[model samples]
Target: MKRVAILVETALASGRNILAGISQYIREHDDWSVFHPTGYMGATDIAGLVDWDGDGIIARISDPAILKNLKAKNTHIVDVLGNVQKSPFPLVKCDDRKIGRMVAEHFIGNGHRHFAFLGFSSERWSFERQEAFGQSLEKEHGQVSLCHLNPRHQGPAHWHRNLDHVASWVEGLPKPCAMLVASDQFGPLAMKACERSGISIPEEISIVGVDNDQSFCELCRPQLSSIEPNHTRVGYEAARLLDALITDERTSETLLETPPLSLYTRGSSDTMAVSDPALVKAMRFIRQEACNGISVDHVAESAGVSRSVLQRRFKDQLGRTVGDIILSVKLRRARDMLAFTKISIPEIAERSGFNYQEYLNYIFKKHLSTTPVRFREEAGR
Candidate 1:
């Protein structure tokens, strides 16, 4: 049996999912035995485990000195997180750049030109997303205002402690701004600050985040819209690449990219491109009831407008028909259910207000450019 060493950091769901996938693979494979030198080792302690002679090392950290030591021994390293630098070993990374572009597009589509980025202090992924965001916005000749929240300053105390500082930043920002956070952890804090400051979500301010940690997203009031990084797929791919390296079937310096993340647009990022109050309310009602067998008539009645009037207003305000909007919301909700729940496809279809799976498929392909299972797989990861 081949022995493998695991070194990782704590407090991030991405890291946890990677480790879970690796452990599951180890248990199912007979030829592999694991040696965990320590649980969730930090960057400074990696050198002590360097001489273990394990077949490979899988971790989410990317320190230059640590990589130097590991490479000196010809150890195989897989970068599950997007922090590694140029290395001889294979690397697997989430497409943080694409995620940034997608979220920026979503915000811009909703007619938000004033932008802000709630970023972590010193992470490579943070920088990558921030760069992609700026590049994407520049295409429209627009600018993104940025804010960096130092987690250390927030301290380990109640996250609420940071609300005052965060609120001050929001008050200074221009209205109708779209913000993207570094991760799910910081996204909620930002939302809390917004709530405390009387800044309404998807109205006064719309926010997006990376790493769709559902528990955290749902836990926030109004729910959070986030970009789901395919962490599990990254983990699986890294393990397979590490296996290939350990078996001597592949050489060093291999690089692999996971598929782009499929975004989950919830209440937080739900808004129209137009500034019409009636149309915005109609859009919100459609979003809220879309997964419950909603129809054009239902939406029209709920919005207290005639079907013809609703259709005209929707097309004029949202650049789409009422039917199109309903289908879009239903399809998106179906995707969310498919991703976070173990429900069957047919059941998901019914619950998401679609009468048939084929209808679901048609709409999903039309908007998201992917199938339901593929979306779920990417989101689950």
Candidate 2:
């Protein structure tokens, strides 16, 4: 049997998901003797890792101590945690840049004209994510306000300081802005800051985070929306690469980036950044009920307004009529399904509230200037 050490933490969903993937690989191979610790990587575990003469190691390497210990190991090593930009070992981690771009597209699609990115300054992955997010958002929005919450002392005082700083930073930004936090761990911190600042979420501010840590996301007043990085795939790829290196099977020492799975929408970011409450209500109603072949009248009734009033509001606020908004929403849904799924064109039309495939083609040509198939092909690249 091959001895392998897993130095990833067990406290977070990301780490656990990586472990789950490793477990799956080991079960299939039945040759790995894993040396994973019981909880978070501590001093004792680090010592144990130093003592163990494993054939290979897969580690987050967030702590310098872990890196130092790992460097001393004369074995094949895979670093899953992307804390360093250039490292001695091959990296198997999430595509943080793509994650940022995805979240930026999400917020931009939801009509956010202003954006902010919050993250830790010490982490290379966090910085990379923030850079990609700012660049993507700034192309259309002109400028993205950036903030970094660096590591500080462990206490309630520092926590309160962070809250105050975030509250101040957010309060100064333009209203109806979307905030893309670096991770779910900071989601609640931002939410708490908003609570302190009395800024309503998804109205004055919409927040999206990375790593779909459900427990942290759900614990917030309005649940957080996050990008689900495929850590399981990362771990599997890591194991495959490590096995190749262990057996001297000609493995390349380079970084492998696993693309994110999907964005999990939640209460925190499931709204447009519009100021009009009536328009917001109408839009939400249409989004939830549009697939049922709802019309402008249905939208008006849902928002408790006359058709004419709703139309005027839509024109004034969004420069689009009620019918136009409904169609655009339908088109967006259809486009997302096309890019992400293998559903047929006819079924996609039916699901996206288009009555016929011919109509979907016509709309795509008119509004999107491309056929559904072509769009899917382009999106795949």
Candidate 3:
């Protein structure tokens, strides 16, 4: 029997999802006793890990002393938390660089010329995301305004002051700007900043954050758009690495970055940065009702414009017709569900406003260059 210490915290959805992946690994194997720490555990607590005697251990930790102790104990370790820059254990983490580039391309595709990034100066992960975002924009001959806060100083006074600085940054940003936050936790903070400046979202400023923390994303005033990192794949791959180490079949791989699932759009970034009232209204209408089988005529009527006018305006401003925008919205919804949920293809088709499963397949192939099932497979891994 292989006694394994699974010292992963379950406080956030990401952590819990990692545990789910580990659980999957255990189910496929035999005689593996899993010991997982539950509830709250303090950082830098050696006892939380040292008390357990296991043949192999998989933990998301950062304290150097703890790492030294684990190394002395000679148990296999796989570090999922990449916050520690140089740990002896192998690492399995999300690709923050890819996530950053993905968000940049999203904003650029939506016709956003002005951009900004919200993050913590204290965190290495945040810095990495910010750098990647900047590089991607530079490739497109664009740049971003940066507002990074350091949360090392704890207190209400410090938090409020940070919020104020964020507000000041927002107030100074160019109009019709698109902002990318390092994580979903800070999405609402930026939104609050916007509120302080009396700025409207998806009109003056559109926000997209990384790490699609559902609670943070949904609870925001306009709901947040965020990049969904594949937490399950991180855990699953970490467990696999640990298993390999346990079996004395360790390869040269020391760090493996799991790819992001997809960017889920919500009210925060559902519209383009355009000033045409009719075009904006048409976009708003299409985003809301596109999955309800609405057509270009319906979108035109909702915008109080004729179909010809709406299509012409869409091409002028968004470089696409009304039908393209409608199809894009529907595809985004379908893609989100495919990557994040277990909804069936037929059900996804109906919910995405497709008349039949075959039509959904046709659209997926014609647009995404792959079938829905294949997309799900790639996203899941």
Candidate 4:
């Protein structure tokens, strides 16, 4: 059996999910033995592992010395980190460009015309996401503003010191703007800045962040919405690459990119940018109750409008009917479960408001052009 060393943290949910994927690959193949020295952030001490003589290594390399030491060992290695600086090892990471495009599409679908991106200046991934998001909005004839934290303002204290700057930038944006923050950590800070400036969320401004860290997302004043990256797929692909490398089946240093699962919608971005209060209420009700088997009539009643009036208004403002909106929400949820969970298709159908698995499959094929099983298989790979 090939012995592998995993040098990734277990503190963040993303990291844990990556480890889970690696474990899953090993379980399925039953040919690999894994070792992870865990403590204090779960970072492996390279010096301590120098003599371990592992056959292959999967690591999130943060320090230059880690690379130097691993190179000396001459073992097959795969990098789970997507650092801007190119490394000698193959990379497995989430597709940041696709993530940005997804965020832009989500905001545009909500009738938002003005957009903004909030990120750190020093992070390459953040810059990539910002650039892609801006390009997407531009293609749709929408405008995007940008705000990046200066590199000098790096840590918590410096970030707090720049709250006024963040507030100023946010306050100057056009009303009813949707903003995408780089990560969940930066999201709450932006929310705090907005709160301090008395900007109304999901009304005057809406915020979305990357990495759906549930605790952090839910802790914000309006509860932040976020893009949930498919880290499990990243890990699984990383393990597969490393296994191939160790077996001499692959030699190229390639980058494997996994698409994000879905956007985890929340209170922070629940409202559309349209001016109709009735339509807003209807959309909100549909999003919240769609998975409970609610119908277009229920949405109209909840919004205090007649079904015909709601249909006309929705078509005018959002370019879609109420039934379409409900189905979209259900389909999004179904896709998320299929990608991120091992739940059975029948259970997914029930949870996503479909009465039957066949019905779900039919709708998936009609709308997504792929069956649920095929989608899940592709995502897992």
Candidate 5:
């Protein structure tokens, strides 16, 4: 069997999931066995490393000195993290700019005027997200304030700690503001800062983060909303590229992998309206009970509004009818399940509030231009 070395440290659930998806893809159809080294070492260790013949390597590190020292020019190198700016090997990475724009658009769509961004002090991804977010806001004729937390900033020890700075910044922003944290870890941190400062989520302030790590999001009091970066696709594509290199199938100078960004709506950033209360309530009902076979009448009745009036109001405000809004919500739910869960098509359809599998397929194709199976496959399941 062909072998590949995997060097990774600072493992998180998101990273593990990415690798797991890649591993699954490789295991079923290939003769490759993955090897993991103990820890991340820079140029020093790479220079002295001795290795038996293996096809290639997939790694998160992209330090120039390290890759150069490894002296494995003949071995195919797949860089999944995109840390290496320029490399001879193929590269796969989360669509950071799209993620930033997605979060910005989502916040603006929900009727947020004042905005804020919380992220690491200095990082490439952070800069990318900030730039994209600012650009999107400008395109929408809006603006956002930014508060960066230095990586070296100690918690509470330094008077200028990230959380303290963030809390101060949040206190200054106008009410009903939406803040996007760069990473999932910072979501809860930002929330805690809000709690300490007497700020309420989605009411006084709204928040979103990148990386849809369930354990991290669910653990927060008001479950965090996040952007799912399609890490699984990144892994799957990385594996495919590595396999090609292993077999000497193709020799491309550089390969870039891009995936669509998806939003995982949750409590922290679930505000559906500021202009109309009834519409927001109705939309919330549709989102919650779409899987329970709810209808327009049901949503109207639940929101204490007449069906005709609700329909007119929804159309006027959202540019879509109440029924269409419900369908959109159902489709989005179905799409999320198809991408994240291992459920069958029938189950996914039902869970997403579709009457039948064929209906799900039809609507999925109509709206998303893809079948459920294809979505899962592309999602790296």
Candidate 6:
């Protein structure tokens, strides 16, 4: 049996997912004994492992001392964390550029003209994501504001001061701007800043973040929307690479980048920034009632406009017809359910406002060019 030490934090959902993937790999392949010291926020000490004589190490190396200690073991190693400047071991992580472009596309599709990015100045991943997001927006003739918090700041006092600065910046932004935060932790902070400044979420401002931690996301007043990273894939790949390293099958510093699973839409970034009150009402109605089998007539009636007027106005402002918007919302929900849940196809169809599973399959193939089973399988991999 190979002895492995997992030096990853378990406080965050990402870490948990990674550990689960590693566990799955071990169960399928070989008898592996895993060791991890228990503590909060990855506060476990690496010094204790000096005499454990592990065969391999998988770690999110946050400190140089940990690297030094692990290197002394002369074992096969893989780094799962992407925040470090450089790593001698193989690295597996989410594609930060793809993440940024995905968020930009989602915001732009919702008709946002103004954009912003909130992240830590000291983190390499944050900078990469911010730069990619800004470039994507600029490509579409949109403007993006940038904000960075110094990583050196610590404690509640520094946090409050930073929150004040963020609130001031948010208050000064042009109305209805979309902001993508770096992580789940920072996303709620942005939302709190908006609340302090009296900004209406998804109305005056919209916010999205990386790492779709559902518990953390739902904790905010307007539940946060986030890019769900493929951490499980990251973990599985790390295990595969580490196994190869243990057997001397792989020796190079390989970097594995996985695309995100999907964007988990929520109340925080759910609306478009169109100025027409009727259009706003129609959109709100569609978002809330789309899964209930509501039609264009219902949307038109809710908006207090004729079907012709509603269709024309939707095309003029949102660039999509009434029927298309409803379908889009329903399809988005369907995709989310398929990716995140194990619900039956008939149940998924009912919840996604499709009349039947056959129709859902038809539309999925038409738009996505794949069956729902294949989509779910791809998501799992």
lDDT of 2: 0.83
Q: Where is model 6 more than 4 Å wrong at Cα?
A: 152-159, 251-253, 275-315, 319-381
Model 4: how far residue 219 lies from native, Å = 2.1
Q: Cα RMSD to native, each candidate?
A: 5.8, 7.4, 5.5, 6.9, 7.2, 5.1
Scanning candidate 5 in windows of ten residues, the lowest lDDT window is: 40-49
lDDT of 3 by residue, 1-381 (tens): 888887777756677778888888888886688876565532334466657788888777655666777677688888887776678788898888999999998988888888899987666678888999889988665778999887564345677887898999999998788999998878888999999898778767899988788888878867799999888889889888888888899499899998899998887997778977777677767767899988888998988988888888888887888888889889888887787689998999999898678999999999989999999999982
TM-score of 1: 0.72
* Residue range with the least summed lDDT across 10 consecutive positions in model 4: 39-48
Q: Compared with the true structure, what per-residue lDDT tens digits does model 1 show for residues 76-105?
A: 677666565665556787888888889888
lDDT of 6 by residue, 17-120 (tens): 88888988998897788888766566346765756787898888765777777778788889887666666777888888899999999998888888888998
Error of 1 at 220 (Å): 1.1
lDDT of 2 at 90: 92
In every candidate, how many clashes are there?
Answer: 2, 1, 0, 0, 0, 0
Residue pairs with clashing backbones, model 1: 88-253, 231-381
lDDT agreement with native, every candidate? 0.75, 0.83, 0.83, 0.83, 0.74, 0.83
lDDT of 5 by residue, 99-179 (tens): 888998898788787778888645667778888888888766577788887666644575436667778888888776888
Q: Which segments of model 5 are wrong by more than 4 Å?
A: 38-53, 62-74, 152-160, 251-253, 273-381
When 4 and 5 are scored with lDDT, the better candidate is: 4
Which digits, one per residue and each the tens of the lDDT, describe model 4 over residues 177-196?
89999888787789889889
What is the C-alpha RMSD, rounded to one decimal, of candidate 5?
A: 7.2
TM-score of each: 0.72, 0.74, 0.74, 0.70, 0.67, 0.75
The lDDT of model 1 is 0.75
Ranking by TM-score: 6, 2, 3, 1, 4, 5
